[model samples]
Target: MAPGARRLATEVVLPVPESGDPVVVELGAGAGVFTGLIQELLGGRGHHLAVEADPRLASSLAARHPRARILNDDASALPQLLAEYGLGAADVVISGLPWAGPDRATQRTTLDCVRRVLAPQGAFTAFGYAHATRLTSARRFRRMLGSSFEEVIPGRTVWGSMPPAFVYHARRPRPRKSAETIDLLAAQLASRAAAATDMRF
Candidate 1:
């Protein structure tokens, strides 16, 4: 990661809850670059999960950051992995994953997991190198984000980094009712209507 890019990624607004500590999940935590900064941000008050798909890098991350739990798994399984640790949602998700990839499908899958695990008002920050912005994968990723998030904000370019990069800040829309919840509500309404008809008869 470029120096400027690292700063941009760490500068993301972490919306901590009013009561307890915030939950942070870092994806593609390669070489522990942004790992330390995130730990400092959390200040040991909340949980930080560093996920790296490579076993060797995951082991290194564990050794370097004892305060964080290293998950040696794919980023796409973030929801399930968080559940194993008894964490339902994350307040902020900092991703260093290569959004402009060999193909867009894998990146989409990983992003879907990021959205799934984030709290309704949570923020997701990711960086893309300036040079790669013109790539087809990058363009597609940006468009996908626009459709996925309620608000998608772009940060200033970090020219200090080797190859300048910019940050993409995204927030999900307000939480929507679950399918089961809607079904239950419909059932209750139907029962109430039947009761009213029977009373009239």
Candidate 2:
């Protein structure tokens, strides 16, 4: 769970598109903490589709934010959900899930799903605990994140939250790299990840 600390809903502001009538997607929207914030930022402009895996949570979220078009489905079904909803690629995708908790294959699969539905210049964000970034799965997750996008920038840690967490803002999603490029990417990712090691959440 990213930024679980409730600042009475004032802790962090979910990033929204600057343009009018933008399409925003929310993944793992537990209890609609950021969902409500996103709606307020939208201010009746554009569409907000929230994907919550739990049917019970989705049902309640649907009622709480009727404007969001809540879907009780997995995040991996994002592209299909967008097509069925008749919406094009998303302008922004926000995640409230604890991404590092999953295995490598699962994380890669989910990232692929997100890449498939993001607009060319669209941005994707997910928050995680900085302290855990050094763990094996977390490192793998970070490496995959770096490879999936041309730019993967970690956001400021919300120290106000219990155990603290930070968001990752990635843009310019990239396709799978060739073997030669993969070799070079490994070097780049190492340097990038190393630079963030001293950061505190």
Candidate 3:
């Protein structure tokens, strides 16, 4: 809701790699506060795609960070969007979205999408307000985060933020198996089923 402090932005983008051409994605990139910082950190190396559902905000963010790909679409569609863009998976995902506001289903689905789109070694980051952690949605989000990834680390509270928030740096998401693995397994199962049917015939 609030434009995050620069310090907060710094903490949020900590997972971004300094080396190589990383596929970085950002969700809920409101007003491009974190977007600009990410772009600066990237230094024009990686493909940065920022998803902002709000058309106006997406447009503004696109204008501000022309180098970054700003999409006017829901964050839940991240996997499909990556496929459409011909990218394999995200190396790092930084979210500025408010987890406390979204319902339980929304939270689960979005995080699942992120996990599916993440590379095996990818990292994900999202923030929560300290004062709001006791709320139902916020508490549920924390639990959801824990369940979503193999490792979820809550960073120190950013006193500079308007309401004092901490970032959750998650790694090694538990997205079942890679898409290639799933496809291969499906093909193998179908082959086995066909062989059994032929034998019965």
Candidate 4:
């Protein structure tokens, strides 16, 4: 495994419990290294959804981790994919997605997808190369998560793995107002404004 990959697996496993299994979703599971750790963490007690974009890797994961449901799909489709499995939400979401080369828009979309699938009180954890921490995309990624999540914390570094990495943990946002709710209120205001405008005319 690559240095970053190894470090990611180790970091991802840190927050998981040894018992009282929790439903987990792993996005961008490259080669099942982290998947293996998650399996060990859960001890075959909870449900795991391993989402990988690569067909070859997904197939390999399905074979190796029979306890996990492997999905050969993009991370952006996480919400719909979880519904297909009859999973309303997950207790935790682990991401090994690469953020080095991606633009800010792509990063934002990825984080939004993660937010959509996270359950109340659930967390989304991911690791990025330590060197890439200064990049604008990385900063924006952290900012966007911070805006939506109640808490955004950085965990310990995994020095054993290559290039080193830091884990980012974020808790789900409390419901102040959902998008649908905001839209409805906006429409009502617009309607009232139009009525007033008509009366003025």
lDDT of 4 by residue, 57-123 (tens): 9999999999999999998999899899888988889988886567866876777777777888888
TM-score of each: 0.80, 0.83, 0.84, 0.80
> What is the TM-score (0 to 1) of candidate 1?
0.80
Q: Which residue pairs collide, candidate 4?
A: 3-162
**lDDT of model 4 at residue 40?**
80
Best by lDDT: 3
Q: Write the per-residue lDDT of candidate 2 for residues 101-176, one digit (tens) a residue.
A: 9986688788888988889898888888878988877877777877788888887777777777777888888865
**Model 3 misplaced regions, further than 4 Å:** 1-4, 177-201
lDDT of 3 at 97: 91
- Model 3 worst lDDT window (10 residues): 178-187
Model 3 lDDT, residue 178, Cα: 48
Worst 10-residue lDDT window for candidate 2 reads 6-15
Ranking by TM-score: 3, 2, 4, 1
Of models 2 and 4, which has the larger TM-score? 2
lDDT, each prediction: 0.78, 0.80, 0.86, 0.79
